[model samples]
Every structure is written in C-alpha cells, then in structure tokens.
Target: MPASTPRPVGASGPELHDHLTCVAAPATWLSPPDGRLAGGPGGLYVADRRVLSRLVVTLDGAEPEPRDAETLGADRVRFTAARGALAVERVRTVRHDGGTERITMRNDGDGIATVTFEVTAAADLAQISDVKAGDPPPPETPLRDGAVLTGPDGYEVRLEGRTEAALVLAPGDRFTTTLTVRAAPPPVPGFRPAPPDGPPPWARTPLTVRSADPRLDALVAQGVADLGALLLADEGDLYCAAGSPWYLTLFGRDALWAARLALPLGHEPAAGTLRTLARHQGTGHDPVTEEEPGKIPHELRPAYAPGRLPPVYYGSVDATALFVVTLAEAWHWGMPAEEVEALLPAAERALAWLGTFEEFVSYRGSAERLPNQGWKDSSDGIQHLDGTCATPPIALSEVQAYAYQAAMLGADLLEAYGRDGDRHRSWARGLAARFRARFWLEEGYPAIALDGTGAPVDGLASNAGHLLGTGLLDRDEEARVARRLGELNSGWGLRTLTAEAAGYDPLSYHRGSVWPHDTAIAMLGLSRTGHREQAAELARGLIAVAPAFGHRLPELFGGQARRDGAAPVPYPPACRPQAWSAAVSPALVTVLFGLHRDATTGQVSATPLPGFGPMTVTGVRAGGRTLTFTTEDGAPASD
Candidate 1:
C-alpha cells in the first residue's frame, strides 16, 4: 500500500498539529504555543478570516527569548520570556468582540532601564484556507495605530495596537503595555471585552466524576471545560463549532454527533442543536451549494469569498439523516414534548429528503462539491480496495446505517407526538431489507459503500462497526462486524482501514487514521449490543491514549499498533480541542457507565462495566433528575 498520496493540486497538508495557543471567544486566534503573538501561523482569526498575520515585539532591537508557555484555559494563554535585563510576561485573553493582550516588562538589574519598545504588527486579510495552504497574504498598510489588510470583496482587517517608543524603569519596576485587536472599534475607552458567559444551562446539570486515577479526573474536567468553550450561540440557541483555526463554525454532521454523545450531560444542548439546524434547514434548490429543500447543511459560516462556500452549504449525504436521529435520541432522553413537537416538521422534511433521492443519499457535486461529503470530507477519502477513488454519487455504508436509524427513530418520534409516520416506518423496513441484500458481502462484512452504479465497493473498513445496534444488522451480522473491528483495532483504537486493505495509510486523514469520536460511536454501539468486554477494551484504549495528548483527545491520530509497548503515534496537524474529539470523553464515560434513560418510566441508571477502577460519578442529570453511581472492587452501585 502507498504510504502517502500525492498532494492534490493547489492543496497542501493542513497543519493540524500547528504548535500554537488558540484562544476562542467572541473571536478566535492562534499564537505560538508559548503564547507569543510574534507572527507566523499564529494570527488572530475572526469570522473565518485572518485579521493579524504578523505581530512581533522587540526591546532595543532584540527579541525576547521565550522561557515558558502555558494555556491557562480555553480563552486565556500566558507566556514568559526574557531579554537582557528585562523579563517579559505576555497574557492574552480572547473575548467576545476581540482580544486583549497585556505585556509586562520588569527590570531585574539594579540600574535604571532605558530601551526602545517597538511592536511591529501587520494584517494580511487572508482567508483561513489560504493561510493553511501557505499562500501569500495581501499587502498591508501600516496605520498609525496599527495596520490594515484587505482581501477579496469588501473584507477588511483593522489591526489596532500601541507600543511606547521607549520604556524607562527603575530596578524592580514593571511597565505594562496593552494591545487590542477588533473587527470594530471598542465600545468604551479601555474597555476589555468580558469573557464568554458561564457554562450553558445543560452544562450546569450536575455531572461530576471522581476517581483515584488522576488521569480519569483530568479527562472529565478538561472535557467539560472544552465543550463549554466550544459552544456557540445563535439567537439564544447553542451548538458547538467543529474546531479551531479551520472549522470554528456550525457543521451539521459534527455538531449532531457531538450533541448525541453529550446526552448524559443534558438534553438542552442537543435540543438547541436540533432546533438550530432546523432553523437553517435548506429551503430551496441551489446547485452551487448543493442545497435542496429539507436537507441539513454540511456547514454554515460567514461568506468569505465567492466559490469558496456560500454562507451555507448543504452537501453532506448523512447529516440530514443524523439530524433526525439526534432529535429522536434527545426526545427519548427526556427533552420536553413541546420542543420535540416544534421540530417535527423539520424531521419530516429530512425524512422525506432521505427517501426522495434514489433510495440513497448522494452528493450533487461532481467537480464542485467537497470530494467526500461525509465526515471524511477530504478529497480521495473514499476509495475502492485497489486505491482508486470511488466514483461520485457514492453511498457510504455508515450513512446507510445512519439513514436506517433515522427512519426507525423518526417514526418513533412522529408516532409519539401524534403525527403520521406510517410511511417512514414502512420505508425503514424496505431500506433495511434492501441494505441487507445489497450491502453485506460474502467476506463476512459489509462493503465500504455502493459505488455510483450500485455495485458493492468491497473494502474491509471500520464503517461497518457503526452498524452495530442500529437495527439494520441481525445478531449474526453484528457478531461478524464486531469480530472484524477487533481485527482492525491497532490495540489502541479502531483503524479506518484494515492493514491488508489497498489504500491503507496509518497516518492518512481518513484511510487508516484512528478518530476518537469514531471509536466512541462504535464503542457505544457495542455496549448497547451487550458486548461489554469489547466495549470496555475500546474505552481502555482511548483512556490509555488520552494522557499522551495532554489528556485532551485530538480529532484523530495515526493508527500505528500498540506493539512492544510503544505509545500511539500522533497525527500531525490534527485539531486538539475538536468538538466531537473532546466529546469522546463524555461519550466513553456514558458508554462505560451504561448511562441511559427511560423517559416513559422516568428512570435513569448506570451499570458499571468490570475492570474499571474505583470511582464515583455524581450529579449526572437525566429524565429531569440527578443520579449518582459508584464502582468498587469491580462491582457497580448507584443512587
């Protein structure tokens, strides 16, 4: 198998693991991991555009040597450095409107200090994609306050800051300089934008976990913090952005899955996510964006340039299905009846779209759409077993599973809410029968997808693992899928492609990478199917790998096996605080604890799996009540 594909024309490696400190707030930006905004890949990003590209600080013609850097929280970073007799500390806070960076210079020597303090700042007004591709930014004008950069159309980058011409300080004295950047002028003089509001209502729903293992505690704490920070509000509703630097915007499939996995936290977040997507549901046909009436959008972001992405794009083949599935899950998890009823129309639309297009969801874009519109959106993501790209209008196997679950679950929700769903129920039965006949292979697994001509594109992949417990597979099929997934497991997590497959690349974005959320999905399915031991093993891999990445799971990592006791290899350029990525921790905890609810009976329970360490999880809210669970000596108990 080829280790890497030739870089696509005009496409470069997405620096997923860019060593930078990202502060996401009213606006978002990246700086050197040491918290230095001294230019480079670290720049201020607002509305998916780079505002300030190069910012450097100098003292007497010398740059400070960074000594230490630490991310204080999701929206704050601090760095310490020194140059000659001056010690410098930089504190950066990302706020709702812009950012406030405070630089403190202290004189350490026992003499008066006089040195020039020059801050060279410029904005390149580049699109985030251009920046990621290493394209040159436009020319910038150095205004007296700062510099302004221009981009295509009327987009503008207004950089504003001030530095004293010279700093004079006595021994032990400190001089502080404040720099601010904004898309618009600050509301008041010296007004520092406040931090984002406290955690959402669902986040406050009393979910807590404590264990003797410090790693477990850290994972839970950081997961909560990161999820809270990733949440974005629109018209009083909340949904998480996909990730930093590249995708800090609404993504239909990503947000849907994240919200579903977060059900253990509270249903309100999921409810808001469902409603938000419904509000933006595609209302008409637009081939440019692949938008069709009733289709859920693949992404929603500020319009940067023509032909890039319209403010909204509805190209995803599975997000529409996943939307109905999430709504159904939320309703069953105890979302209010009125809220669920309000979204019934949107659910009907998504369900109708699911069946109207040739009994399969296919992307409309052949040349213009994202190469692969599913979660694996990278070009050349879907492939036949021979390393050739799967032709367009492809039907991914996992998407069929999503559609099956959506149809059945949507039927349940519609019936429960006194709506006519007989068509959905009947359609689901037919799709499942067709799927079983067409998708299952004699090799004891399912194909990766059905090609444009409806022939099975044979490949052993982790996609089949998502079929577990979705009602599309029988007992025998689920067992085969479970066993096949075990073979694909690198002993750390599930690999997207088996090693024997033709296009396998352990480090590739989709072919053979291990995505945390993907593993979490399969793990949840396994647990639901009564495969506790297998589920436990899957959860263990994620726990074992968490500490390697600061206990914060990244979007995906290399699929190198856990042999000879070597740690899992990292995927360079993966997003660290990715929404679905951070969401895996909670999802894993939910699965291991058997955290599920029965709203019809008003019961919430957890069945602790074996081999897990002694721990107590308190304040878990479900079904309008808070519950606690504890495990000791491999036994489970709850309150």
Candidate 2:
C-alpha cells in the first residue's frame, strides 16, 4: 500500500459510528442503536474473543423498531423500541465476565394483544485480532440446549434466565423478563485479575469541576467516568486497559501517559500503574519479543500468534523513557516517599536503557517488529513532507523530548533519595544540545524525525508541540513551535500532521487524525511553557467538541475543520473510552487551573487562565490532602 493511500476505516469489520459501547474492563458490549446484536462486531466480547456473535430479539418474528437509546453509565445502557402497539425496552448492564439484559414490553393499544417474545443467540468464539484483520473464522456448529450455547474451544455462553415466552397482554398491561448472559471463556494462562477491592483509585479520590461553561463540567464528569471504566487489575495492581473493543489489554505507553495525565486526581493510580509495569519490566533480550534488559514491554497479550505480536513485546522506543517520567511525576505529586523508593530500581533500569541510545533514541524497523515505534505506531506514520515513508532507523522528535525529560527527572529522584545523579544530569544536558543543532529545520520548527540517512524528514506536525515543555528548546524556540501549532489546529483539535503535507488525510490513523490525548499533551506543554493563550485555545477546541461525542472523547477523530453546526467527524473504528483520551479531562483541569505541586517545597500553586470565567474545583489532591479552589473571572481565589 502506498503511504498516502487512506485505509478504509473499520475495513471489513463492523462500523462503530452508529453503535453504542458499554465497557467494564475485560468485557465489552457493542451494539447498534437498537439493543439487538445481529452479527458483525456488535456482540459480547470477553478477553479478546467474541463470545456471542448473533443475538436478536423479536416480537412475533418481527424485529422491534428502535425509538430511543440512553447510556445510563459506563457499564449500563437503556434502549427503547416499539413493535406496532407494543413498546419494548431493554436495559443492559455489562461486567468483566458477561452482561445482563432486562426486557420489558408494555401494551399501549386499546385492544388486547398477543405477543411472542423470542430471543435467538449464537456464539462464534472468534479472536478479535482475526476479526480486525478481515479474516473470516471457520464455521462453528453451536449446539443450543435450552438457553445454553456451546461452541468450539470450550466457549460456553449461557442465558441463565427466561429468553422465550408466550404472553397475552390486556390494554395497559406490561411484562418484564431479565436475561443474564454468562460466559466461561477458556482461561488465559497469564491473565491475572486485580484484587476485588473497593471502588477504583480514581473513584476513591473523586475530582469534580464546576465552571461557568457547563460543557467543561460535563466533559470532565464524563471523562472521569470513562477513565474509571477503563481500569484493569494485574497482579494486585491496577492499570488502565488501553481502550475498549480491541485494545482492552495492557499497553505500556498508554497506561503510563494516562497515569501521568491523571496526577491531579490522586497519586494512587500512578502508584498502581508504576508497580504493575515494574513487575513486567524486561529482564533479558529476545529478538522475537524485542525485550532488552531494563526495557519496558510495549504491550501484553494473552498469548503469541503467528504473524502477530508476541505475548509480551518490547518494540516501543519511548515507553522506557515514559516509565521514568511517570515515576518522577508521581513522586512530585506526593506519592508516598516509601512507595517512590520501592520503585527506584525500576526507574534506574529505565534510565539505563535510555543511556544505551548513543545519540538519539532510534528504532530499527523490520517486517517482524514495529516499523515506527512512537505513539504513532502505524506503518506509514513516519513520513516525509512529500508523503514518502521515512526509512528506519528513525529517531522521532518526541522520543528525544521524552528521553531528555526522563533523564532530568530521573536525576532529581536519585539526588532526592541520596544517590549519585551526576551521570544522568550530564547525559540530559548533552541530549538537549544535540537536539537543538540537528532536529531544528530551516522552517523554524523541529522536523518530525530523522530518517535512516540522518537527514531531517521535515513534516509540519503536532510532534513538535511536545518539545515545548521538555526544556530541550530555548524560550524563543518554544515560542516558535507554539506558533506553528496553530497551522495544525483543525478548529476542533490539533491535527497530527498539517493539511499542507502530502500524506495528510483527515481520517488517516496518525497522519492527520485529532487524538484527544495528543492534543491534551500539547495543551499541557503549552501551559507549562507560559503559552497560556495557545493552551486555552486548544482547551476550548476540545471542550467545544465534547458535547457532539456525548462529552466522552474517543481515541481519535477526523482532522477535518469544525463547521458551524456539524459535529466533528468520527473515525469509525476508534475506541470510545480510551484511557489517555478520557484522562484529558483531568489534564484540562491541570492546564486551565495551572495546578502544580512543588516537590521540594511541598506547596501547591494555582494560576488560573482567563476566558473560562468563574470556576470551582473540588476534590483535588495535593500533598496527601484534598483541596478545593475557586476562580473569579479566571483569576485565582481561595476556596
């Protein structure tokens, strides 16, 4: 495929734009507006496998006409439809293992009605990766003995309650039945559930914001709710699953960035995430899995498959550095001193891994391994301005920024804990000096990356925005990059690549899509570098588009410019409750309120931005204490 050719969104898989999602960790239910799951990707999936492929509800052999659908919460939804004079309602609640649906039929006709409520279901037991690759699974003969559905591979889906019933209803009468779908999927060998504790860490330390603009409040509430739903437990520690439908598994980069963005909520999430990744830190080198000593694995899956990634892969170049950055930020956010000390070994290992990159952090691309190993891992993600792909070993601009930040912060942690930190500090200084001389383009902003020939692959992109707060650039250079970001702004959010670039496709995965998390990262960087106006502009863009997507941002959306009444274009296959995208809510609070805690002084500071009007935020955590703050006309005020 050519680099500029746009891959069809969702391809042969089911379309998600018109569907609704209800997710709870390892299990998720995706269905059309109507409650019926009639084949395709709209089914009950558990642990990367589809348990039920076909589930349809009918009255007298006719499907109900959908009338309304409402999402009650992260794990529950209510759908209403009608069949002639009978009004039907279905309430679904999803859990990690399975889901339950309560069906109610109310007759509103003047005359009596005879209705046969029938539910037909079947299981295919298809792997999600195969479905994503457009590969059809072999036909499986499923035996339905009463409400039990038995399929291949020891996959069993049981509808424990009543599913078929014959009823005669009088005028103004109603009938209700609850059907519980339970699945016992083949146990994944390495999968471990987090201990069943109280609510998730974010839920325990609730953060709420109320501002004059109700959209900001709604976006925050929905984002927090979505974040709580994405939390998954591993070895008694909690970390966020990347997203729903496809990426409901451990991803080092996504989990670390999400935890870092969510620091204002509390430090418990960061602590849990750090501990979880530390337990899986790479201890040896394997060419197949790309695991090197002290490196962080890119992602974790149940098992390895041919022509796919390994069970535990370490193909990413930035995750190790992000691991160090996240740990240092967690410490600054008041993660317990003892807790920080316990993870110092892992942080030290990550710093050492960064040291192995002599000049810049670069990845050797191969057909077996990821070609472009930054956050944008797409094959064609790293391209020149002319739409030609950049040959590896590619050194991404943002990876250098992350490495620089990690080295500086790692030194701080080492020094604070009475360890030698001179080496890391000196390394960071050299990185900054080299980055300035080699990465900057004649156009003023940094190049997206350096190609294999050590030539700057110049592409005007949002990647340059990440350099703002990393201290890799001087004040004047930071201002220049911030100004260039405006060219990538699509009126809704920052486009990954500027439209002027040849590879710019509004719906391309990484080339031009507007990822909320990416925009939030730039917002944080802009705010930190004293470009509050630019940060506020990006903040408003995200807030303005939140309502169109039900205030719960998705993984990414089209980079098309926003119109007067039209909503931002949806990328059909994007994950709705993505961890880092949802974490953007708290990130907004951090940027807008200028919330920061001085690690050495143990003092919290707030520098509110103008234009958000009066605002009040409660449940903010700082130095092991809950705080509340109010802003008057965008100026800081005491609670």
Candidate whose TM-score is highest: 2
Q: Model 2, 1-639: lDDT tens per residue? A: 224545555333445766788988878888988878666667788777777677788999999899999999888999999999999999999888888888899999999999898877767777887866668764643424346665556666776666688999999999998777777765557644332245676576578898888999999988888778778887667788898888888899999999999888888778888898898898987888888889988888875222278778889989999999999999999999999999999999999999988898999435457788899888888889999999889999999999999999899899899998889989999998888899999998999999889999888998998887987888999999999999999989999998888988888889899999999999999999999999999999999999988888988888989889978887777888899999999999999888989998877788999988989888888668888889886687565
Q: What is the C-alpha lDDT of each candidate?
A: 0.76, 0.84
Pairs that collide in candidate 2 are: none
Alpha-carbon RMSD to native, per candidate: 4.2, 2.8
| Residue 326 in model 1: lDDT | 94
Give the poorly placed runs of model 2, Cα more than 4 Å off.
1-13, 138-152, 191-196, 304-307, 365-367
How many residue pairs clash (N, CA or C atoms closer than 3 angstroms) in each of the candidate models, in the order given? 6, 0
lDDT of 2 at 140: 41
Error of 2 at 191 (Å): 4.3
